[model samples]
Structures are given as structure tokens and as C-alpha cells.
Target: MITYDPHKWLDHFFDIRGSLVKEISGRVLICVFWSAGVVYFDKNYHDVNISSLLHTLVGLALSMLLVFRTNASYDRYWEGRKLWGGIVNETRNLVRQATVHLSGERDLVVHLAQLNVDFAAACMYHLRGAKIAGMLESQHPPLTIATQMTFALQEARRRGAITDIILASMDQNVQLLIDYLGGCERIRKTPLPFAYVVHLRRALVVYCFSLPFALVDTYGWATVLDTLVISYVFFGIEEIGVEIEGPFGLDENDLPLEDICTTIRHNLFALVELEHSEPDKMPEGL
Candidate 1:
């Protein structure tokens, strides 16, 4: 996500890197030009009249559409954040359980805890749609980690390192990981409906372009700046919705999955007091 001082409002506004303004600049230019045309036309024949009465009704409808669109997209973004939060919590619980129950078998506990880190990272990679690469060359990294964790648990049970009660408690957290994975997948696979998106975008474009015509008659040449700002708001809101709706990808606005995954790894290693390579140097999927 884009990061800077929130208090530095001007700096934030003017910052070009990773700003949605860059993506919508071309559309803004169109609005400016369209408004200029409205000015020229009004100066000459004055036949073009995109009436204010019509705009009042259309504007209300368009505002509602953009509001709902942004709200729905933000809901998905928040939900995705909560799901990853769940993953972080459950992973910690599972590893802590292993460390506590397998007190005597530090090696086994260490192994399983390390695997939990792997599992968390794998899940992040899975959600972000990154193909497994390097040491994690598998179709399903999370599933692979799940399998290893399961095998280790079974071995611990067989060796009497953990009782049925402890195993069951640990299994609950493992189940939670599975649930988190499925929950994230559901969000990832399902998107805002295509029809809604198409209709809203088409409507927004037409409205922003036509706005200049509707307002210039009343506002005079000043309508250029007015239309430009209004179009920016409309387009920016819709574009923001599109950016966060998925909540997973390489986009600047996407979840910081890499950092989150690395944190899981570093925390797991610290919990076990097991030496690990520096997070920066660690291989991918670690």
C-alpha cells in the first residue's frame, strides 16, 4: 500500500508514485477537453443542452452507484484483511501448542513450528496468485505444508510425545488454517459481478463527459475546473473500488503479503528460539 505522512496532506495529494491519479489522468484530460467543447459550443450556437434537471436525477443515481460500489469493494478488502489476521492468529496458536505439548521433543516442536511459518507464507502466496517457485515448486504450497504438519503430528502421537487431548487441541488450529485458506479462496474467486462493473463504468464515463455540458451553461468557463474535479472524484472512487475489490495482487494497494508472510516466519523462529537466516536472506517460501 502507498505509505507517507498522513499529516502532510499536500505532499500526499501531489505524490505521483502509486497514486490512482496517474491511472486516471487520461480520463481527466478527456473531461477537461469535453468541458472546453461545451464552452465553445455555448459561445456559438448554444444548441447543446444537457439539462440540469436531468443531471440532478442522474447525478443522484450515479452517486448511489459509486457509494455502493466503493462500499462493497471496501468490505471485500476488510474481509481479506480479517482472514489474514485469522491466519496469523491461528498459526501462532498452533505453534505455541506444539511448543508447549512437545516440551521434551524440542526438535519435533521446532520442525513443526517452522512448518507453520511455511504454511502461513504458502497461504499468502496462494491468495496473491503467485506461482510456487524455487524450493516451493508445488501446485499447492499450503496443502503441502498441511500434509507435512499432519505427518509430524501423527508421528508425535505415535511416539507418545503428545496425548490425544493435546493432538485434538492442535488439530483445531490446523482446521482453522484450512478454513482461512478456503475463506480467502472464496473471496479471491468471487468478484463484484461483471454486469454491475460494466454498467457503472459506462455510466460514469458518460456522466463525467456530459457533466461539462450540463454545468457550463450555468457556471460559465469556470465549469472546466468544476467538471475536472467532479470527474476525478467519480473516476477515482470507481478506480479505488476496482483496486481494492480483489485485495490480492501486485498492485500498490494490494495486501502486503510478502511482509506478512515474512513476519510469520520471523515470529515462529523467535518463539522457538531457533536460529534462522536473516529474513532478507531467507529463500522464498521459508
Candidate 2:
């Protein structure tokens, strides 16, 4: 995941530079060839009739639309990135509060803190469409409800004091966990609208196909190179937009949620002054 900061664009672009260049180059070549062929055919058969004025207008519109498309897609990508940034901060905040509030209640405190870490990892895997087996190792649905209630009962018994104030504090912290889970679900379930994706895709394809028609009349065989060059830029932007729309996935350019989850785990563990231990080996069929 690109860190959520303004100064690191170079690092982010460098990370995905090769893939970007490759996609753009392919599109440029395609446009160039199509443009050149159309020009050649027009000259040979006297069939081309596109006016210079009309060509210029079409080119202008195409350029504007491409720019707009690039901006819109980037906006969506950045929004998703920002949402993940919120998740990271919220996770840290939750741990900090839990540690401070639950002090002196060693077992209850440690377990709750650990669960926060686990939940963070679970959310990350779920968002990326990765298998959930690892995150769900200790508990399963239906059973988890009962198990969670039982765990709460234990924590209630283990509270620092039996006063109402302590109970209220515990309740508040527990509710924070619920809120975090809800936030993750919101991001994972809600995607950019289908119509927007469809429209963008259609626009890109139309521009690609029309490039040959637009350039063929003037450049003839030379239009091939021109089309290819322009197509490279346009296609590269379109492809990047597609990759970024759902930024949670495992793609190279997608947010690195796993790394973020790892950070949460380390932070929570450190706060409790717990000696770090390697996670237990997962079971054979787990």
C-alpha cells in the first residue's frame, strides 16, 4: 500500500512504473498502426473526407474526456486509500484506549488487545478477497457468538472492580470493537457503481477505435506512429483507473492491507509489554 502522505508520489509511481509503461506502450503501438493503415487506405482509394477542422475538434474532445476520466478514476482510488488510512488510525486509537482503560486487568486486557489485532487482520484479508481461514482459526460463525458471549462473561468476572463504572468502561471499549468491524464492512461491501465502470470502459474503447478514423485522413502511413503514441497515454490511464477502483485487492498497485495489519499487531503487542511470541502453527486442515 502506498503510505497515506503527500510527499511520497515518487515512491508510489516508481513502485508501479514498469506495469504502467508496458500497458501504455502497447496502446500507443495499436493506435499508431490503425492510424497509418487508415491513411494509406484513404489515399489509395480516395475514400477519406474528414476535414482538418473536424479532426481538430474530435481530437480536442478526446483529449478532454481522457483527462476527465483520469481525474475521476484517481479520485476514487484516493478515496479508497484515505478510507484505509482511517482504518489504520482507528485501529491504533482503539488499542491505545484499551491499554489505558484495561490496565491492571491483565488477562482481560491482554485478550481484548489481542482480539483487536486479530480483527484488524481479519478485515484486511476480507477486503482483499483472501481466504479467511487464518483469521477465523480460533472461532467460527454461530459458534463465535456463543464463544464471544462466554468470553465476555469471563472478562466481566475478571474486571478490575465490580463497580458499575468499571462495567460501563468495559462496555464502551467493547462497543469500539463493534464500530471498527462495521467500518471495515462498509468499505468491503460498497463498491463504485456498475454504471460508472461500464461508462468509463465504453469511453476508453470508443476513443481507441476512433483514433484510427480521426488520424488516417491526414497522416496516412505516418498516422500509425501518431495513433500509437497517443493511444499509449490514453490506454495507460484507463488501465490504471481500472486497477485502482478496487484498491483493496492483491494486485501490485493495490493497498497493502496485510502490512498495515501487521503494524497494528506489533503496536498492540508492544503496548501491553508482552514478550513477543511467534504465532502458534495453524492446524493441518485450518
Candidate 3:
């Protein structure tokens, strides 16, 4: 996602990198030209007056629908972030426990830590509908990594490296990884209802096109400016909702999954290095 200082109002006002201006500029221009045409016809040809009161009622309803649409999309975006946050926390917990509890077995601890990093990377790729380089043969890379981790934990428990209780606790963390994966998949697969989106878009177009009729009577030639500003607002709102609804792609406004995965990898490797370098500080048992 694009990051900026929220306190910098002047910088943001002039910034267009992550803004919807490019996406909605064409629609806004169409509305402006349409308004200019309506003004020209009214001035030179005949009186073309539309009921301003009727347009006012329609505008109120459209505004409410737009608000709902934006809210729903934001909810999905926030939920995706929360689910990834859970993944980050659980991965750290599992690695920390492994580092302390299996400090003597440095090789085993390193293997487990690598698996956690792989699982996180796999999840990032899976959500974006892509595949990791070596794991392209695997249908579900995250699940495959999760299964490997489970088996490794089981082997550790069988060989007396860890007790049944410790194994169970670590296993729970692995299960939570799968749960987070499921949540991400659900959000990616399910979208807003088709009919609702279609109707909302249609209403936006109709409202924007009819706005000229409502404003030309009073604003005259300046109706072009008014329509341009109003249409830009409406179209910009809708474009933002569309861009953030999935929250997994590489859009400027989408979640930064690459950065998040890199963080997980760095954290896990750091924990492993700490365990190896300071084995004397680690406790004997869990």
C-alpha cells in the first residue's frame, strides 16, 4: 500500500500517485461535455428544463448507495489486514517457542524456522494467484508447507526432542496458519453481489448524465464546471471501492503482501541466529 504522512495535508492534496484521478478522468470529462451540450441546446435551440426536485431525490438515494458500497469494500480490506496480522503473531510465537524449547537441536530449529518462512511466502503468493519458484508443482503451497511442519513436529515429538504437550502447542500454531489461509481465500474468492454492483454502476451513470439537465437551467454555461466536479467525486469514490475490494493484488491501494512476507522471513531468521549465538542463555526445557 502507498504510505504517507497523514498530517501532510498539502503534500497529499497535490499527490496523484495513488489517487483515482486517472481512473475517473474520462468519465468526468464525459459529464462535463454532456453538460456543455445541454447548455448550448438550451441557449440557442429551445428551453430544456428538467425537474430539479426529482434530481435532488435521486441524488440522495445514490449517495446512500455509494456510502454503503464504500463501507462494504473497506470492511473486506480491513478483515484481510487483520487475518494477516494474526499470521504474523502466530508465526513469531511458534518460532520463539521452537528457539527456546529446542535450542540444543540447532539443525531441527533451523529447519522449522525455514518452514515457517516458506509457509508465509507461500501464502503471499497463493493469495495473489501466483506460485513460488520451486513449488509450482504443488497445487496448494501453503497447505503443503503446513503438512510438512506438522510432520516435522511429529518427528520431533517421537524422538524425544519435545514432549507431547509442547508438540501440541506448536501444532496449534500451525493450525492457526491454515485458518488464516482459509480466511484469505474466502475474501479473495467472494466479491460483492453481481446484481448489486451492476445496479449501483448503472445508477451512477444515470445520475451523472442527468445532472446536466438539473444544473443547466440555473448555472448556464458554468454547468460544465459544476458537472465536472460532481462527477469526479462520484466516479472517484466508486473506483476506490473497486481497487480495494480484493486487497491482495499489487495495486497502490492494495495490501503490501510482499513487504509483509519479507518481514516474516527476516524475523524468523533473526530468531534462529539469536538462538544459535546464545545457546547458553536458553532455558533447559519448556
Best by lDDT: 3
The full ranking of all candidates by TM-score, starting with the best, is 3, 1, 2
Q: What residue pairs clash in candidate 1, if any at all?
A: none
User: For residue 199, what is the lDDT in candidate 3?
Assistant: 98
lDDT of each residue in 5-24, candidate 2, tens digit only? 56777655555443667666
Off by over 4 Å in 2: 2-18, 23-28, 58-68, 134-184, 274-286
Best TM-score goes to which candidate?
3
TM-score of candidate 2 on Cα atoms, chains taken together: 0.72
Q: Per-residue alpha-carbon lDDT of model 1 for 1-286, expressed as tens digits? A: 7667988888778777777988999998998998888888887876566678887899899999999999999999999899989988988888877777887788888898888888877787788777766545677789888878888888899999998888888888888888888989999999999999999999998888888778876888899999889998989999999999988788999888878888888888777763334568655876
Can you write out model 3's per-residue Cα lDDT over 163-270, one digit (the tens) per residue?
Answer: 999999999999999999899999999999999999999999999999888888888888899898889989999998999999989899999988998999999998
Per-prediction count of colliding residue pairs? 0, 9, 0
Model 3: residues with Cα > 4 Å off, grouped in runs: 279-286
What TM-score fits each model?
0.90, 0.72, 0.95
- Lowest summed lDDT window (length 10), candidate 3: 277-286
The alpha-carbon lDDT assigned to residue 243 of candidate 1 equals 91
